[model samples]
Target chain A: MLSIPARRTNDVTPSEITPREVFERRRDFLGTAAGFALGTALAPLSAALASEKPLASIKSPLSTPEKPTPLKDVTSYNNFYEFGTDKADPALHAHTLKTRPWTVSIEGLVKQPKTFAIDDIFRLGALEERIYRLRCVEGWSMVIPWLGLPLATLLKSVEPLGSAKYVEFISAADPKTMPGVNRSVIDWPYLEGLRLDEAMHPLTLLALGLYGEVLPKQNGAPLRLVVPWKYGFKSGKSIVKIRLVEKQPQTAWMKANPREYGFYSNVNPEVDHPRWSQASERRIGEFLKRKTLPFNGYADQVAPLYAGMDLKINF
Target chain B: MAWWFALSQGKRHVGLFKIALFAVCLIPLLRLVWGAWNDTLGANPIEFITRSLGSWALNFLLITLCVTPLRKLTGWNWLLQLRRMLGLYVFFYASLHLSTYLWLDKFFDWQEIVKDIFKRPFITIGMSAFAMLLPLALTSTKGMVRRLGGLHWQRLHRLIYVIAICAVVHYWWLVKLDVSLPAIYSVLLCILLGFRLLWPGQGRRNVISGNFKPAQE
Candidate 1:
């Protein structure tokens, strides 16, 4: 039987939470012995808290029936250019990232502009597991079980001013820590943004962990955003700053190639990228390319957000 | 260098060299098959296959380009004998690369596939390059060479230079950054094409005295 832990509202006691390294070691052990009955029995329960179901009261009707992508593929195949441009570079190079003593600054047009420690953010609301379909702009998709609170919970606490129209997320860019920052792969300190309402969507996640354990550094440790309806790059990783702005802020990819990547990178199959068709995507674990869905199959929920707007122009 | 001399000795040895080159060319495809058999194509097997075949196609193009310059430099006039086979392998790998996209990636959705060819810049360039290669491949046979006559066939085959440029551009535009690999290919192509420009008639003697005589008849 799968055990869905009741959502915890209060601060998690340190003793109850296992260290990331210990959890990873246990996972490696389990993976090696996964062919055995014992490993098979404990596999789903151990890896993720939410096994094919959303947490109680999370209201995730957009979730897919697809099994979550294996932890190996999820961790290994990533496009976090802060580590390197190659998909595997993050997995190899992100270990040097120090995620513990992290803080996020909420500035710009917010009424209560302040920096919050990682712990303080964790204590804002109950952490719940949400299984979401993460679609990349490169025409690949993955089902991920993310552990985090909704972005709305954090935004409400920040108290954005009436003038605030866009919310920008800035990722960490310490060159000493992230070697890829030294290279001119992208403009340093990666930036992503969403409209104020989009940021406040129930599906928008401020993720801190994945697979029941603390997030692997490659998978964006300490803090990240998971905007399920948008392209994966819109979900900035290792986020250090959240700035509420009056106008649409420039995002990293859009700045790099505006024709290819737009500010509103909603997963619309009809709007093809300049380099490739977006009508279909290969799910990471699956062999066949599945037809891509508008808004990554979250259209029923997110389509209203872009109602009457041309997605092709927005994209 | 020693192996080139040994392999270039006589007609029988030249035949042996062609067989050896054929086996050597099959290694990459064989390795891919082995990788598939071992379930080692990584998380996205289709992507792995697609990228591998595309890269092999480009690599073979580079190798095909190298043959003319190598024949000119080495004076191993028999080296010209392998050019047809090397050129054919470029078409082979390129055909596989296109088939991977058409069959495996798109599943023969001709409407979407045709839309992709027309819509995407990279696909447009790649499809054009493949289209150019088709005539060159069709006319590669000895019988067709006789039908077209020598000068016309050579002129027609010169379309390869354009195809090579298109192939490099296809790769360059497709990559999202870190263009070191494509840059290397571009520089190598420049050197090969540049050599041809710098020394126009230098290779004519070698071609006349070499195996190209029989094909001219």
Candidate 2:
């Protein structure tokens, strides 16, 4: 049984997991004991901190040639507002988050609504190594080699209704676990959305891990969306509720400041942020700022989806 | 003669205290240098260095501004001797902050730097504050005070008030969300600057006119 008390009594707990938690803890103890017997005190302690087991994945054709940002740098310099606004806050505070016994409820305008266990989500398809160029609205970029399958795999399982136009992702914002939720920094539960077609794009990833390992707690452990064609925030983190809707879903950033953020936050250097220029972005490891590419260098694959739409107005 | 000269006369430990103060002021820079050498300045080292220098400048500015009040409350008239050094340190840190921006952040891309200065209000305000601090720093010496005259030098240094306001606003505007840290700075600055408004004759004669007489609490 999960000792980390559930937020809601009605939350579905699969019977098999009751023993799994205890087994996991016992295995962890055994692993630590074995590690100590080997006379490597640091091996277990370091592993205990967050070993984030290496996930099973194959080389992906979609992966970019650019060098991936250093794992420590990638994990530490995150902008997940759920934990806090500062880049380093998530790395420090996210350890309190409980990733196991998690379920993502898929409902609304779907023919076969389903509640997916974390295991079920992983079992969808063979995972791939997607090295993506992630451009943030704040003018910083990172090339991340992520481990995951297409988000469309999960979406196809639920089979959306004809009326569905957009897919909304809602992040878990437990005030008890996430201290940042106590503050009135934007609406509590972080929300992000994508056009139904955009959500189904081949480049759009249902990211499970990074650096060939299960994601660090700070990098939205358990699950997160990675929309390479859009601004980094367009990819929601620790997504709990996924909904297919008739109208374009209102995003957290959009609600916070509609004028600055919009429904379509595609990467276009020409359409600058109201406060700052988007022409150039400082790559994480490198000193020189690189010119931001259209659709973050995925324009060939994604631009066709928005051929006629004016990005300037939609942005 | 200034009231400080009479009261501060023959202060036995002031020299040693100044040497200690100078060393204490270098600690922030020392820590940054050590961090750089050790590769522990977080992921974004340049940003960390730039922000650290800016924060130190703001802290030194506030400390410099607080000297008068500290002297009044504690009757440590010798504290006045350290105020000039403290004010100069604000410029030292501010100069490093600007240099980091130009060198590490921008790579001396003057065109882009100019664009940032004009396009970003926060940058504009920050640059203006640094620009104002330059004249005060240059005229800090006794010779410059004599050449410019006491009244003129005092007027020139009064720009610290404006410079401090700009520094706070520059910080407050740049943060994307959670202004609580900057809000704390703003409140402390308000209390420090508020003394002038709340004091007798609005602290003009004793402060603005260089009236160094000890204020009766």
Candidate 3:
């Protein structure tokens, strides 16, 4: 065409001639087609792949690049007693939980008590990614990247009364669905609670997802509490009810064995558990036990919250 | 009656049974080694190995306890021949369990281990039980039995009953909430100890000697 500029040997390639818009449009088409193909290919396993989503972008100074616990370990090694007593039992049994259409009732000592769908809870605030160290009462630890809003944001929306000293979390208890609930390993409708101030702390998270995906069933799908400074058990999973109360709530483990599990359940290295020493903890991916940190190494941020309180007595 | 006499003679097939039992006793350890080699000890290998060894030790203790009652009830007095071997396996497993705690779990941190032994009730009881088991395991040889004399050996071996109790208590105290397994062991122990109370002469007569004879036969 028009002598083709004398067919110069140094001319631009065909890709260079292509318009940027056209290339972008082609990429978009290909992406959609691949997604559709993948969707069809993974149809049978949709339930297993139900919660796979793009990672959230919200950042914090606390977030670490130290590779989070493998998704396999995070999902499999859990202590959700509603499923069973064994650590492996929750992963084995919790998949039966239906997370969609989940609702959490925020009642008691609130000016406006409401039962909000999980989606609505998400809409309440922008979800942020927070990587935190979860130390279990059994002297095991895991680094979890949780995606959620701060608990204070949610509590503030509900408008708590002056009398609300404690916030009690009630987990779901459908025995027909949760096989472990049929057994009396723990009291039904597993209950956990925190002091109102602790509940409202910026570190306290109402977690909706983990590892850049929506929460897996075993890791407490749809909704759970993530208290970075406390023992993992204190962070109740699959929470259905949040009741702001005047009196201290009788937590499940404490009710089960008061001497062994206390109400506060803070991560204190000096305070040995009744049956075993808590001076050291085994991080899940590591071999040698590492010395346990006071307040799980959140002593700088959260220690001031418990300024005068004796951790051993409160623990 | 001739077949029964032949079976209880404690000579024929004794070596074969002893070899088989020896292999069987090593199965747990072999399986644990294989598991460690293959990286199949799950998320917490130390906990898994410790628990497996501890349970095996308790099982052996119960098995050793069962020997007297079984020998008396079945009149297969030759079962006495296996008691020393079974008791020795108990010591083997218990020693391995303790070593896992001391060497592996504590990493030779003697100060912390000692603190744990003193502060933790379960560890304290467990260490006490291991201490009680030491002399019995050492005296398991035929030479030791001959040197100590049968009466003294029997008196020393009576410590097994207390060791059994201590082992069960150690297990019972270690569990967080599910005591079902320990409860089952306790009931079995009760039946074994109760049977001795009901029928007293079984333990006294069944104590084996180096030059053995079937007491009932």
**Tens digits of lDDT, candidate 3, A1-315:** 000011112333342133566444755644554455433523422332344555332444555445466566788888888888888899899989998789999999999999998867766654667889999998888888888878998899999999999999999999888888988878888999999999998899999888766888999887899998899999999999999999999999998899989999999989988888888998876767999999898888889889899888899
Model 2, position A171: C-alpha lDDT score = 95
| Residue B67 alpha-carbon offset, candidate 1, angstroms | 1.2
lDDT of 1 by residue, B1-217 (tens): 8865575574457777788899999888887777766656666766777888889988998888887787777666677788888889999889988988888788898998888888788999999999999999999988988888776677788899999999999999999767878899999999988988887775455456543443321
lDDT: which candidate is best? 2
lDDT of 2 by residue, B1-217 (tens): 5755644562566777788889999999988887766667777766788899999999999999998887777677778788889999999999999998887677799998999899889899999999999999999887787788766777788899999999999999888767998999999999999986776674567556576333111
lDDT per model, in order?
A: 0.80, 0.82, 0.81
Return the DockQ of model 3.
0.22
TM-score for the second chain in candidate 3? Answer: 0.89
Point out where model 1 deviates above 4 Å. A1-63, B1-12, B203-217
TM per prediction: 0.84, 0.86, 0.85
Steric clash pairs (candidate 3): none
DockQ, ranked from best to worst: 1, 2, 3
Can you tell me which runs of candidate 3 are displaced by over 4 Å? A1-57, B1-11, B204-217
In TM-score terms, candidate 3 sits at 0.85
